[model samples]
Target chain A: MKLQRVLQYAKTLLSESIDAGDIAIDATAGNGHDTLFLTELVGEKGHVYAFDIQQQAIESTENRLKENGVSHLATVILDGHEHISQHVQQQIGGAIFNLGYLPGANHHVVTKSNTTIEAIEQLLQLLKIGGIIVLVIYHGHEGGKEERDELLKFVSSLPQKYVHVLRYEFLNQKNDPPFIVALEKVKNFPKE
Target chain B: MKLQRVLQYAKTLLSESIDAGDIAIDATAGNGHDTLFLTELVGEKGHVYAFDIQQQAIESTENRLKENGVSHLATVILDGHEHISQHVQQQIGGAIFNLGYLPGANHHVVTKSNTTIEAIEQLLQLLKIGGIIVLVIYHGHEGGKEERDELLKFVSSLPQKYVHVLRYEFLNQKNDPPFIVALEKVKNFPKE
Candidate 1:
């Protein structure tokens, strides 16, 4: 198909923003897929921060990274992504958030809009100019719709002069499929 | 920006489907920019069909194609796009529609939802497998919103087994910014 699927398109944006030796983040490390992908994109010289609130997610991500021999390149944190600002101090090339519950895990433990927004706010401050923060939103489960709607509202209100918000989705699919919302920082916000 | 803007994304999809020696169509023609582009996409050995209801649009498109030294590559027709099947019978590699009133033209004389859907229906039938139809939707003017809504409803209902309907838009911008809805035919439909 000429149109890229949601997962492929998410990587495309992240790959475009990140180069070898650049810093990246997997906001919700889930099954360690994106974290591992980030390690490959940034290479050994670079660093990745994988955050997950659940111990199972963190352990799985760490094992996957170590099995690939890139464990040292990423710091797996067992904490909510809302505490990202506390963990990451340096500028980042790109970040990705798979905003839903972990697959095969508890369905109720999904990412909420408030903490997601807080994490996004901190990421925006940490993102260098031209860097992107991609959100792959899955809204099929209970409470998913509310998170998606609230996040859309917040992102839509972001000033165009400082940010560019892109919404890419497939409209004709059956199940409520996940879509991508990418935020690119064009200019620095006034020091607050 | 890593995320392609509306116009560029439309061209990207069209270019992907069209080859040097294939047929293409500019469903709206408008100011002739996309018509001229279609001519270039299909080289000297190929053909393009440009349709518009306004005489001024046909004239401008003709002039533009002539100035570009490719007027012979296209057949400029002064008629509504709903009558597309009557003018062309060959399978098309790709097509594009700039839906709504022609830019810089009278806003009152806008393209309606029914006729636009008719044109789309005909285009889908004529599109070869893997061919695409791109619609750059501008819905700020009078009657624009209605057309946009109706078009979305129609496109969203297209069977995913044979077609992939992609909606690409930037949501942070103020002025009702234009967005893209690209339909790619992945498989042939059963004969009716």
Candidate 2:
């Protein structure tokens, strides 16, 4: 399937009945495929908080949204992992991250596992009960294997009652450029 | 993940948003995991038509349902792919097939691609609008590669307006047993 198709499918999977007028996030707004999807799903009344570490990525996403006539529905922030919680205030409906470097630019500045996992932790807190988080991991580049492995390990450790995790990829394919990792937060999180 | 967990997740996916009085099918009754799931989902006044070529599979499934106290709700038929249309009369709410062999049984008596494709054709006709058909394909065995590749090709060939196909797998894991393949029949399927 095409990359945009994957993003579209992710949006459908992550959406719940409660998301009719709720907030959503795009943790990695690479090329704006996911950003556009989130904006459309939330409609004019709902809000989208999108983040991209690279200025070029942000600018490209901004341009794409403007061309698609959905820029007003989303807040595109050019910030790293630390600013997400501050930007996203309301309980979130869903969040999606396409984790890798930009397709045609900055091939070397890929996402690191440490910061990605940290971002995941922060985003998980932002999600409400039955809310979902989707991560598309591209483990075909430098440090890709380590990141993929670490993310799997972390997700596997999630307690059975609090969260549900799913991984989707084409096993018959050769090199794994990217695969979909999804987590849904349950309502009754136990007191820590 | 354990096979039981996978089965549970599959059951959840198949039952979500479905009503208690809707009809459903288990195209493969391997160990009756899905057959039993459908039996419970449809509840009283509803019916399930479970099909498998192997008599042993049928016996095991019947035994499982009896063990679970749901035998009254299901009909386990020891029949081949061509018998689906004959058994499932009305449009169904959902159908599922755990394609591959019965776990820990004779792996030689596997579901073939041609028969599966034919069964799918019948199911599309037998499905109601907004109904679902889920196929769990294990592409790690001897005939698995062909089945997986061909099934993907067939599902991909469907018109976008008629059906929505989703492929879910883990790209990181080596020799992953199976992944989910789900198809949702659009409301506007052309009248037969």
Number of the top-ranking candidate, with DockQ as the measure: 1
* Candidate 1 residue lDDT tens string, A63-156: 9998999999999999999999999999999999999899989988999999999999999999999999999999999999999999999999
Candidate 1's C-alpha runs over 4 A off are: none
Model 1 lDDT tens row, B18-100: 99889999999988999899988999989999999998899899999889999899999999999999999999999999988
Give each candidate's interface RMSD in Å: 0.7, 8.9
DockQ of each: 0.90, 0.13
Which consecutive 10 residues in model 1 chain A have the weakest lDDT in total? Answer: A99-108
The segments of candidate 2 whose C-alpha lies over 4 angstroms from its true place after superposition are A1-95, A98-192, B1-6
TM-score of each: 0.99, 0.62
Q: Which residue pairs show collisions in model 2?
A: A168-B169, A169-B169
In order, the first chain's TM-score in every candidate is 0.99, 0.91
**lDDT scores in order:** 0.94, 0.78
- Model 1's DockQ? 0.90
List, residue by residue over B94-173, the lDDT tens digit for candidate 2: 88888888887899988988999999988888887777788888878888999988999888777766776766654334
Clashing pairs in 1: none
